[model samples]
Target: MAAALAVTGCTSQSSGPSKVSSSSGGPAPGDSRTPPHSAPPRSPSTSAATSGKTPGGGSASGAGRTPSSRPPGQGAGFPHCSPGTLSASLRQLEAAAGNRYAALVLTNTSDRPCRTQGWPGLQLTSEGGGRIPTETARDRAHEAQPITLKPDDRAWSRLHWTVVSSSGDAADGSCPTPGALRIIPPDERHSLGTGWDLGTVCGKGRIQATALSTGEGPAH
Candidate 1:
């Protein structure tokens, strides 16, 4: 009986060890739970890294797009002329049949070369700096050409008006004499002023002007 009891106690102790070993061999609940939680953080970080590259690629593509238009004279390696770098003068031409004519001359006073094209803006003012009623009409018969003016080079425009009064003139059949002439370069805002002694401009102060051309105007 003593030997049998000792054998039975040894069997119970062995069974307890086997149960403990089996439970430990299987995956721990903490290990499974840790992997699932840690795995979610890695997935979000990977997606964030991928999304960050998309905007950088989009910006690179946008930088390759072309502009719709370029500024004038940009292709010629020269800049547009400004009023500050120019000097203006008037050359009176011969008068015929109640018509008067003159040449508006512009000289490049700057050392650098500049380009200009199109019609210029003109206005007449009284001696007291008062605005006069002047109408400038373009002569489309002449096409504007781009002119490159070197230092001290010149460009000119023809100006023609009537000295005699027309039906549009005031009832007195008279016109106001301009004391100053304001000349604005093409594509410029500021103006250059010169003295004007031309007696009177008729037909409601209308003046016909031509596009600028290279060199001094014809004396005739």
Candidate 2:
């Protein structure tokens, strides 16, 4: 079973939408990659402090995997963690009509070296039916917000959730239904201004959803 992290003394980690965030003060003189919203402890000359960014997002093909043999960063050994440590977070949870959407806040909390990753994909459950991947708007957007977490650093971004609607634009005001989890990956990205439908299923208690993979394969 996956365990929750509760150790002390270490920097408390968190995840949210990482599309936008002003970097913390104290940027290196030569590194402009560090966005204004990057994590803190910003030094004047520390190459390691600058947040690294990857190429375009990775490909995610989730639908064919044996339970006993999951992919890396998954399965029984998974931390089963919350938004913390994760690169993004759901800053705001909103409800319009009968639909629900989450305003995500993505941030980096480590100091050594790490890069931003993935669009916030969703595996949502339909109202009187089954689940499906929420519409994804990962590609339509850009990751100009650089987040480099020093020993004690932070950065943030706010993003909206994709819903089960085909007539509304994500920026125009479309929300997702209840039960969804944002997808995070290092090597995959969604189509520009488009969304994928995973047919997610809703469960009891907190909203039900899972993160999408960052490669071209079947679900686990």
Highest-TM-score candidate: 1
lDDT of 2: 0.30
Predicted candidate 2 versus true structure: per-residue lDDT over 57-145, tens digit per residue: 22222222111213232222222212444454444444455344443333333333233323333333344334333333333333322
Residue 106 shift from truth in candidate 2, angstroms: 2.7
lDDT of 1 by residue, 60-152 (tens): 111111111123333143455667788889889998999999999888777766667656656677877666766666665666776667677
Q: TM-score for model 1?
A: 0.64
Q: Which stretches of candidate 2 lie over 4 Å from their true place?
A: 1-87, 93-102, 109-111, 117-120, 125-131, 139-146, 161-176, 188-220
- lDDT of candidate model 1 versus the reference: 0.61
After the best TM-score superposition of candidate 1, give how far the Cα of residue 126 lies from its true spot, in angstroms.
0.8
Candidate 2 lDDT score at position 39: 62
